[model samples]
Target: MQYKLITIEGNIGAGKTTLAKILSERLHGRLILESFEDNPFLPKFYKEPEKYSFPLELFFMAERFKQLQHSVNGPDLFHDTTISDYVFIKSLLFAKVTLAEDEYKLYKRLFHIINKQLPNPDILIYLHVPIQKLQKNIQTRDRSYEQSIPDEYLQKIQNTYLEYLKQSDQKVLFVEAENADFLTDSKHVDLILDALSKDYSPGKHYLQLS
Candidate 1:
């Protein structure tokens, strides 16, 4: 890989973490995973979105910033590459959907201040899975809080993610991953690796599983 830092991102249940973990191991790089499970407000946010959404997003913003700051700013040792499941901007993307207009304004201001200081990824890989596939994955994972998520809610988040990616300045490789099961098929991994190997400019580039 030409880049030292790579981030794999997607909407919920799009298998971003799985890909990041596999890539980190394959590349012998450092892995930085999100600690969403540690947030106390997550379960409540799912049960009562209006009541807990702000707190949930706030908690995630703080934690994500701290983790990225440490990982991105720290000295590199034996590992030459760093792979993360998320980008710090994810907080703003999710907040855009979850927060009310007034709340979103405040959140955006905070997000911009914190985001300017964080290190941007050299390569951003976005796994694009259709909503139906995402829902199936969520069901297969069987998380209690994720079980009741409505299609509308998931769609909103996915749309927000796509909108962000469209306007983002980072080198992006958008992969259409609806048909392939990467874990079971080594060929799928090879295909993604091939995409990542090529040099892309500072704009959105796309690759599809054939």
Candidate 2:
């Protein structure tokens, strides 16, 4: 792998973890998967977003900071390529959509403080899936908390991610992934692998594996 770190991100059920696992195994790279299941607030958040949004986001921000410090930011082999299913910025993106305006201001302040001390991904791969497809995937997964996630919420989060990524200075791969399936299709993995193997100028790069 050419990049030291690669991050795959998308809406709730966009298969970020699946692709991260595939690339990690194929390249023998270090993998950092998001532990969303372990969060105690997630279930309550979906059931009552207004009541739980702030704490849910706060919990995630802390967990992500600690996890990254333990894994990607560890005192390990500098040669090892690290792949993560989500980035630190994800906390902020989700917060923007879920938190109250005052709560979000505080969240962003905390986020920027933690973010500056962490390492940015060499490349951020955004798997672009439509809201309809995302909802289908969410339902197929059968997560009780995720079952009620409204399409409007997903759309807001998606828009937040796109806006931030578009203006970012880091290298980003915008994969039009409405039809891409890394788990079932080898070519889909190949397309991502190809992107990982080459270096790109810092900007948005588009791909459609068809």
Candidate 3:
């Protein structure tokens, strides 16, 4: 109620997309899900990250920019609020983990330039699940490429995301999801709704299942 655009984000397999979908339906908001299944570099990147990391991230950044620019900037008469499963800054966070230092530096420059053209979320709910929980969820989803994702990689990504969350200037609900499942738990949904109903200064706000 206090936000015009709500973003659901987290490490891989944290169920952000499911949460975003549920919130969009409940709020009668426009849902913008990242369409990554078609990316040619994704599977290759997982198998050979050293060789494909740059291309993988580059393609993702381009696609995310194009998608968000179109979806967020367009007029939507039917829905007053917009719910997205990702925040644009995740691109930088992820690239920091996967790219070489020089590549990341260059990518960061491009990201800053492209990001200026997109609007930030009014509130971003970052679901923080343990690496083991995230691994289990990733396995359950059964994406062949993601099945082989090492725990070390997941840990790096989690660390990067946490660092960014701590320094973020935007309103963020830092939520722990190790004990909750947004798809099967009604309480989890209520928790998200309650978090979004209040206003907060631009900074991190901690949340949990309870």
Can you give the TM-score per candidate against the true fold?
Answer: 0.97, 0.97, 0.98
- Give the top-scoring candidate (lDDT): 3
Worst 10 residues of 2 by lDDT: 71-80
User: lDDT of all predictions, in order shown?
Assistant: 0.90, 0.90, 0.92
- For candidate 3, the C-alpha RMSD (Å) to the true structure equals 0.9
Rank by lDDT, highest first.
3, 1, 2
* CA error at residue 49 for candidate 1, angstroms: 0.5
Q: Across residues 1-210, which tens digit of lDDT does each residue of candidate 2 receive?
A: 679889898988999999999998998888899898889999998888999999999999999999998888786664478999999999999999999999999999899988988998999999999999999999998988788888899999899999998799999999999998788899999988887777899999999977
Tens-place lDDT digits, model 3, residues 35-64: 899689999998899999999999999999
Q: Pairs clashing in candidate 2?
A: none
Please report the TM-score between candidate 1 and the true structure. 0.97
lDDT of 1 at 150: 92
